[model samples]
Target: MPPETTGRAIFISYRRDDAEGEAGRLFDDLVRAFDEKSVFMDVAGIQPGSDFRKAIDQNVASCGVLLAIVGPHWASITDAQGNHRLENDNDFVRLEIASALTRNVPVIPVLVHEAKMPSADVLPENLKDFSYRNSVELTHARWNSDVALLVEALRSYVHVAKEHETEPIHATVPVQLPPPQPPQPDESASAKSRTPLFAGIAVAVLLAVGAGVFAATHHSQQPAQTAPSPVPAPAPVTPPAPESAALTPFIGRWQNTAQLTPKDSLLRLVVSNGGSQMLVHAYGKCEAGPCDWGTQPAIVDGSKAVTSAYQLRNNPQEVQLERSATLTLEPSADGLGVTITNSYQDAGTHPPGKALTYTFARATGS
Candidate 1:
């Protein structure tokens, strides 16, 4: 069997406030270079109400490559701790890039403005290598040429990565049948008769009885013979078989109300931007119910824009059933109201699934 193809979209990591316009253009170019579905552009791609951090992490993890859109202010931003931090080194970006790298996803550094390329001394220990790597410089005078080169490089990288992703599977050859031996002529007359000696005597006796009965009536009688039975052939052999999503930008601490019921309880879901994958942690309870911890898988599915699906973890039958729900996150047109559709499914014999949709305004101060 051939290796499975790793064809995927690219994740764009950049500081939105610092380079939305340029980043948006760069994203557009990338989409033109490859299947737009496989690329992630933060400027216009993220939806409102959905968990932006979670969405970004999931996108990066699932993508085939990570493109760092470094602008002049990329290294000037401060984390919550007020320390100047490179976007690539930011918690969310780090997680996304690290997850991709963990899976051998290619990473490309594209310089969007006049940001001084960090040297080994100034660069974070983890990003020192990227500092020395060649980058595409997009200045006003050479914007077109720089973009063309970046797109070309991205196209080539994706093409090669896709090739390596697919490996072929080989089928086993069938064994041939041995040649048949020639049939020998029967030496004994008894053997040539094709009937056992006892069976021949029995047939003779029956024929004699029939002759006695039919001769008396002047009817002719003859000995009876048996014909051979045919055997069926074998059948042919067969071979073996082998075997998200984007969400809108909802930046906030949202509660998982889908998990609540008349049984009495509430669950709090914190969808924050962790390094590579979304840091999804759940804590809360129905009236007096116990709380359990777990993680769920996410996917991207949408037409007008990319959508993300985050499946919640749920387990019942035990003393404490884990609360869970699926959130469909998508970005809004104005890039302010992200849509988050949360759904819930029941457990045991009778299960009732419920879905709740809402548009969340981006949290102030995010």
Candidate 2:
């Protein structure tokens, strides 16, 4: 087995009883695009003696992206007892998808042989978001063209296995990421400098209050100065800039109850540009790491909600990168959480997917 990836890795998830053949073909294609060590499938990469569930969850979380190869029988297949395969907690495909969704792994449903995207009613609660994620279709006739679209989008996240490849190149050029840069010492000093300013403002407020109290006490003890000279009020201290309306209830780390699409489908809301501008930092599941959907520029409306746009390569090709999420804060017993309503518009033949809503709890440390 190859050593695991420290960077983002591509994870291919498919049911053996459903699209094993197609999954194998897809794996071969991906291996040529990324390093062989960067692509993973099945128990081939699991070490011996590891707990099955923990191992699978660890592998799923470690991956930056997951390809859910869905074939016609993918959903309807059953166990020997005739129960639906998806209903079983131990079902590998179900477990894989559930983990990916819960952990915010970008799961691009790869429809094989023109398999239709599964409907929400057909899916279990945790897997319902699978119905709405943008999907790519792979048929024997257009396999190369279709896969090239998939490869082009994946380039944004995973490392390219080589500089040359045997696959047909009918689409875009390879994505080249900049090399890592050394951390500058000045930035840390700049970060340090920021602390004193805030501390100074707080100190100023305290001093103002103390002076006001002392003046009143001293005035009471002294007789009124000859003839009243009208004294102007002390200058009003400008209150430190109020926190952005966009930061109140919405700022924090949050994850969806259903656990759909990566990087907010709301991860974290942070202040940027020295708090002059508020930025929402979210992640979509990706290889080598979670693909940063970027710090979404957020605007707050009168409703006390922040609005932002998010894009990802989860569903690439003609239909790649067009999913959207509507987030709102909901008051809970513990505190405020979030609800993410996801919608997708496929630029290809596929129509707009249904809007799926998910409740998100605040992340423990956020």
Candidate 3:
């Protein structure tokens, strides 16, 4: 690492299969609290290169603090071979933790999703020490307090390190010398005597100059010559024309209860125009089940709007499916009604499955 990148940094180690969402949220919060460059999340910071292990080790060593994010399934998660990942010596998470421990770096175990600290018996030999370190819990209910504690700890460490770095190895005490002695009495007396003589000469010269200046001013004075031309008032400034109204046909909150699953699910849509383009944020209400809600940027062409494709993860099957939505708007007596059509495609499939449509009525307030 270069000297510029040597200062305090936080390294977040997490498993995608475990608590990627929590880890990502924490990273974003840390970035805001500290700085974007100071918080390094593995996947976002990693660069393409050979010797991936070397990269991980270097980052771990250089960081001021390492945050090991432990989700519910972190330890027991299995690899493709179906063996426990923590049991494998070559596992990336294991390597990262082990390296940080070996280098005596401060390691903080962050427990998310109400996860408990792993017992010593469950950890591999190299990672057994991790069980003893103090752990912090991050719950959705107390996210602010938990993250504040973590930030305070990291900031304290960085401050101490900086103070230590700036302290002088060997300080020198500045020497003091006595003030100079007073000048001789004869020299002082002569200087004082000459000061008054110079002052008298200056006073006489000023009086003569003042008399001449008074005479010149008295002769040159002229009375109010022809009432000074009346100053014209400034022209009244015209205010700039009001900006053309924004294209905001679909810019408000809309909600609807699906007939197929009435009372169980509610669909909500929020739309706003972004000058050159449009933005749509959709959320599927889940009163009785899991729901996925996300924002997608869309392009607007007249009444038609299409969003970019984004992936939706199916946790149970461990599969990622691509989905995109198109919305068409039509003016109605009550308000503008939107027709949302969503298209889904599985991996390796060309054509998408049958599209689904949902209707939404504009809400009262923006």
Candidate 4:
């Protein structure tokens, strides 16, 4: 294979149902950071009537790295027939991964949406080796940092391939010359006698010719010199100022104006920028008085703003104690609203919890 075609690109392998959204987001970010032609996502690159397996194999072999996006249900998700998808030998995800591993390419398993690395026992024989590879997490809250690390890793391999492509070429040539002949002995005495006289005349003639040529050449080539200009001193260097807080669309006060709770219930959220961190203060009513769900820290990853779990101060005595709440900030379609999910449950629930979602409108003038 030519140096330009050998391990100079990236291939993305993902299950549609499991991580389609995450994979698309990653592809966009990668294209922005690197050459678009060097990044390949199957859905966008594959054509109609193409040999599917052959195309995947060729891409995997030519790519310097492969990113397998694994979502929460990636390993355990079932097909229409209620069978595990990975168990099938002909699964596209399995084939892509197996081909990459067989070719000794770098296969990075990108875990997203709380996905965990699968163990060897859960994988098919052809894909069992994938479990041992080191994985990176691309959470909604850490998308930028995670993708930056991935880009840096792939850059090294790309640099090596480019170096090979630019190597210098060398060539050689052969030349031949005739040998010299010896003088005759018969004319040696007379030749020697005339040598000194001829040499004196030859020397005088050569010197006169050389002097004339040198004087003419020097006169024609020399240019008139002018006075030298003064050199300017370099300006002093100034240190760069530190970056200020990033301005995000979510940086403002928002209030829950939705009507589904008690008449006295009121929810107010305040988001402020703090360099890389986003500070959030949420206040509301649980029954009649203030809901003491305290201040929280959030970070923006892509379009989503996520925060760590905070303990609710007003848990009912009959219910479980030590209950924690996680808040997720989702943007509304019109970009003028935000959906705040105040999830108190530890596990999955459709809609998460009763009266958990609060649609907040951006407070005017704040």
Q: lDDT per prediction?
A: 0.50, 0.66, 0.65, 0.67
Model 1 bad stretches (over 4 Å): 1-8, 43-54, 79-81, 86-90, 159-366
The global Cα lDDT (0 to 1) of model 2 is 0.66
- Highest TM-score scorer: 2
Ranking by lDDT: 4, 2, 3, 1
- Report the C-alpha lDDT of model 2 over 1-366, residue by residue, as the tens digit: 224633337888888888999989888888776667667886556778766677677788888888889999889999999999999988888888899999988777889977877777889999987776766678998897667656655654565536643443344568798999997679778888998989999999999999999987776765667987899999989978856654556656665455444433334333232143334555445433444443444455554354364544443331244566554544456555544455557536555555444455676776
Give a tens-digit lDDT track for model 3, residues 107-209: 7788999897787789999998687555667899868655654554455335332323221112246768799899767977888899798999999999999
Please report the TM-score between candidate 1 and the true structure.
0.36
After superposing candidate 3, which stretches have Cα over 4 Å from the reference? 1-8, 159-366
lDDT, residue 187, model 4 = 77
Which 10 consecutive positions of candidate 3 have the poorest summed lDDT? 162-171
Clash count of each predicted structure: 41, 13, 0, 0
Estimate, for each residue in 40-92, the C-alpha lDDT of model 4 and write its tens digit. Answer: 78645766676778777887888877889999888898889999999887788
lDDT of 3: 0.65
CA RMSD (A), model 4: 20.4
Error of 2 at 49 (Å): 3.4
